[model samples]
Target: MDKAKEIFKVTKKTLLLIAGLVWSFAGFRVFTIGLEDIINYRGNKFISILVGSVVFYIFFKFIFLKMYKKHFIRITTSGLDKQYFFQFFDLKSYFIMGFMITLGILVRASRIFNPVGVANFYIGLGFALFLSGVLFFISFSNTKKIKVQ
Candidate 1:
């Protein structure tokens, strides 16, 4: 059983890489979708894009950056030699992710808000997520250096 469990476990470095890749890919996909929606918007395109850019900057600085730091500390402080593959994110994170995904899908499908408005929000969110992923990669690289030294 231990050997079987080991097959599904991964080192912290690998967890970091996996988290980075997953977040980056999801961010890119969401960002592109927002971009496409904004392109199709008939309103003031420049202002819409500008608003989205501002949102991105604010969220990246205030929210996602802090989240990255917290999670980075958590990962570095964990005592486990290896962890389950899905343990890259804590339980709270998994719940939050699931909720956000469900809400996003429902909102989009129901057209509860203007598509352009949603696009702006998505753009900001996506960029923040992408930046967080980049932070993870940076930490991962630093860990590699630590191991080498």
Candidate 2:
């Protein structure tokens, strides 16, 4: 039991680190490379994109995660007493995550926005989305029970 809890702690930290790294790298690259392109284009649309990305990130990091944590608690009490894992086996989450990943891949792989700063913003946004989805997916593997002190 203690071993399982220890494993969960390790895995959770690792996932969080990986997610942070992914976002950091993507943000760095986007700022350094995308800024120049954005200046060249001289379009104001990048501002909107940047604002939108910030909003989305906040929503996911706060609202979405909170909802998921609640969902996790609910599921843990539903006869899965020995586990405190992520509950993501439902089709809704699958579709939402799949769509986000696919969209990110497509945006990152396409050259249509190469000359625009919005492209870089989207590239970073997509990478973050994909990474977060992966974090959530891996979050489902724990079998540890959360003990109340």
Candidate 3:
């Protein structure tokens, strides 16, 4: 059983790549949903897009970038030669992600806020996530280069 589980082990670089792919995919999905919502909104589309852009800038600079740096450091500093595929994110990260996802779902479903506002927020968040994924890919490349040296 142990040996079987070992087959699922992956290098840190691979983990980084996986993380990038997952985040990018999720970002794309969320972004599209937001775009669709904005398109259907009766309010001003330009304002919605603008709000989204601002949200993206703020979230990326203030939140996602910091998170990327922290996670990148953690991945690079791990002592293990091989880690489980899902180990790209620590347990705390997984829990936080779960909580955020649940919260987002609940908020969207409750419809207490305006749909246009939600769409703008989603757009901003999605862009930040996609950029964060790009950062992970860059880190993966740099780590590969270091290993080759």
Top lDDT: which candidate number? Answer: 3
List the lowest-lDDT window of 10 residues for candidate 2. 80-89
- Counting clashing residue pairs in each candidate, in order, gives 0, 0, 0
lDDT of each: 0.82, 0.49, 0.85
What's the TM for model 3? 0.92
Return whichever of 2 and 3 wins on lDDT: 3
Off by over 4 Å in 2: 1-53, 56-58, 61-63, 82-89, 114-149
Quote model 1's TM-score.
Answer: 0.91
lDDT of 2 by residue, 8-82 (tens): 432333333444454345444544454455556656865746754775577558655554555444444444333
What would you estimate as the lDDT of candidate 1?
Answer: 0.82
Task: Summarize candidate 3's per-residue lDDT along 1-149 as a digit string, tens digits.
Answer: 99999999987788889889887887887788788999888878889988999999998999889888888777767777777889878898889889988988998999999878888999999989898999888888777532311
Instruction: Name every residue pair that clashes in candidate 3.
Output: none
TM-score of each: 0.91, 0.40, 0.92
**TM-score ranking, best first:** 3, 1, 2
